[model samples]
Target: MNTPRLAHRPVPPHRPYRSKEFPVPDTQTQPLDPVALHRDSVVFNALDCTPLAWADETYLGKLAASGVTAINHAVSVSQGYDAAAAALVGWQHRLAETDGRVFQAYGLDDVTRAKETGTVAWFAGFEDSKPVGEDLWRLAALHQLGLRFMGLTYQNRNYAADGSGESANGGLSRFGRSLVAECNRLGIALDLSHTGERSTLETIETSTKPVLVTHAGLTHFVDSPRNKSDLVVRELAARGGVFGLAAKSGFLTPDGLTRRPGAEVFADNIDYLVELAGIDHVIVGTDVGDERKYSREGMARVRRLYPEIPIVGADLDLERIHPEGLGTPADLPLITELLAGRGYSGEDIGKVLGGNLQRVLAEIWDSASGE
Candidate 1:
């Protein structure tokens, strides 16, 4: 299989973490105050953050400010074997830098503790499982090192399977099948967010343990390659898997240029998935990291360099400053308010926030406890 040349948006260079911290852009949008409710709920922003390259007290403050109880932070992606290995090393160093201010969630107990203590419970995840390479044996070692969620592919084909960019839609490679079994045995949840349609559906059938498409749009809404088909979503829900909704402009809209549809569109997605796949299977995964605005020149440069993937974000216009609500971590509470307005009860809201993913985690992790 030919691995397509992927021109990806380069991660921006490190800068000083800004403060004065995002004042809610839409005060008149909702009457319900979700601060206390968000604090109480077990919020998990699946695959939201890119692991930091540098560490400091500012990083600590930004991490805490998300108000998210837990994050399946993608520490590794778009790297070869050596760089991927080093990514894990970097994550370990950052985790150590927290000095217990952050907690690692290996199981439910750790997650509960993080919720109770008001600390960020970060469970390590990778956007692609290519890091393990052909050494399926290494999965256990990485799991021991705190890797809990792993995607089979990211944007393009790997040794495991084809990603969305591949039109062939190949299922698991021989090694990919072995990988699925290893992940099931090791308690690493198989994340199929960027995986191709065939590979994702096949994995759903192959894995004994329930899987999760932790971050992607719904084809039922936008009919994009980056989103899942309705049939796939239904089958996943039937087999006890969870589907997490992502917060990306292109996947969410036609032109992929605005964030205004966030509240209504995201709420409608949750409701649609709930009706089709059931509420138990729907969850949250803002595929974006932090909300850092890019300059027009920066956006233009990205468009010029990576023509395949354009400025599918709010920063399409350099001078235009639109209200980016759910575009970042801070605007997450708006989800709660929107869901409430949609007539979701507290119990249902809890499940959508993190309870669904929480259940999937226990099922996978607890079963592999003896490992």
Candidate 2:
């Protein structure tokens, strides 16, 4: 399938950075206050893989403290239909138990309402499409239950498509094409972050609406196969899709495990993505997990689940997966500061912060209505 190459706005030139270091823009002028800007802006994290007890006061408190207004929370991570459905229902109940403190968002209006109410909005997302199984109706059922976005695969292949971790890039299965059509018809945005190369490209061409790479690193900076190549990234942006530059340290730096790169590296990653995908196509997607996720028990659980995936190997420190100063949602204001320090205009900074994802999501969500 031939996809028309959509033109992108001229990219801003980025200065070369020494490994693990980002140079501050040369200027004597006072830098913009990112704290204030973050507070007022409609900050959206396209994806955050942190598993949390939805009604937990501590978790809710952390979100309340963060500059983020909305988050695409991963509800299904490599789970099959039954498990995924149960998880979705559990989150729904939790949101109901939150006593209006946290709202489960279904569309752009919910985001606006969340901003106006000064509360956090959670968009239910799936990190894998295993839950769909071989049935499109199951997908529609999940969507009606608030499953807004879904990935074609996790780090491994399922019935629909191959994941990035697969040795064989078989692309999307026949079932996958049907899944894409179902997602388009149901107004559910598709995600290709952990999908295999061929599968990712195929899905982009197949989908009627813009897709999302919600959380992943760029292979240009870190030569990890888990990251997306420039070819895939550019194609995604050219088709009006959004690329979420992640905060994973291991994927962000050369010796990320011991080096423990700070927010500077993350800022640089954002800059690299903006240069490649254009500022309008980039957004923040942090994979920073919570305390339980980094616990030794958590590592054991992950290893048991996917022993072959190198990301869960014993050598990696789950706590250091994300760069310093960006380990939690509360620290997101630092991103705005770094972008401003790098000479990004307030308009562009807002776009990167959340505006870009918002625009594409609205485009995808509203596509069904237009049809």
Candidate 3:
């Protein structure tokens, strides 16, 4: 046999396949005890599904096991004020039924207690301020319901402002400015994750208190409208604001259109921000949505499209792929391990993990107290 013609010979003009490449840390060794490293660490997940979104007791247990100390419970993404208010009441009732497995954090005391008891503190937030309604008084009502943070808009335009993805991203409208002022007065944390450029800039300038872009990527990294620019990042940090890096694959990588990279890519994005803004301004906000809803079919399609990319499975295991070594909330120790490998001191890693968010929360709560 003529060497069997090396079955499936390539045709003319065929090029050799090149293996995908990712940066590897120079240090070869990992920490001896990742669990001990994460023992005192806390995860501040800025946005996640609540009961309204189908997150149940099992889910909450998973979250607790994952090491999530607090989550900014998204109460209203598009609900009107009446509906949002009702939903808040419902959540409170559910918490009562769960025997305070989840506590709503309205002030520093609540957060401290949650930390002490190892309970998941629910920091109320509206994904879209649409519920604040045309009337600004509705904001006061929502604030009363312990809605501590407010995202000015979702993925579409609303009365307060244009969303980042809007076709015409004119900054905050007149009403939006008014709403920001009210949010400032009421002691609510302003979030600009999906706000348009103009709106984000205007809100940053208008708010007397430091605002939060709870979860987002850098514009330079992925160039998505949803990603914040370097200028915005610098300004936010200058005002003592915190930028929580998101886990959404689309905004985190250059090839978001294909495969979502793991924590390594996420860490690269974090590295960029830390390099630009320093560790004090960087924090984790996976923006990891309802884990129960992620389907195998969807992941399979993603895998096929970006064969070189690694997709975080529905189980939320970050250690398998993320360079940061963050798999689940429980796997937070991996971050310490990776940071150690990168030569980051314990202090620096602590700040990035939770200290920064704690500072921001304290500032906002203090401002509210004064008012």
Question: How much does candidate 1 score in TM-score?
Answer: 0.83
Candidate 1, residue 103: how far the Cα is off, in Å = 2.7
User: Higher lDDT: candidate 1 or 3?
Assistant: 1
Q: TM-score of each candidate?
A: 0.83, 0.88, 0.80
Model 2 lDDT on a 0 to 1 scale: 0.78
Top-scoring candidate (lDDT): 2
Model 1: per-residue lDDT, tens digit, 1-371?
43222222322222211112211223245444466556567788777655474345655666677678788878787676677667777877777878778766776677777877878888888889888888976777788778889988987889999887777888789999999998988899999988988888778878888899988878866776678988788767767788988766555555555534445767777788889887778887877565453456756765564343323553565322222466556667877878878887666677778888877777788898435
Per-candidate local distance difference test = 0.72, 0.78, 0.69
lDDT of 2 by residue, 29-103 (tens): 655566766776788888866665634777777778776788999888989899898988888888888888887
Residue 131, candidate 1: how far off, in angstroms? Answer: 0.9
Poorly placed runs, candidate 2 (over 4 Å): 1-31, 52-55, 300-313, 369-371
Q: How many collisions per candidate? A: 0, 0, 13
Q: By the lDDT metric, which is better: model 1 or model 2?
A: 2
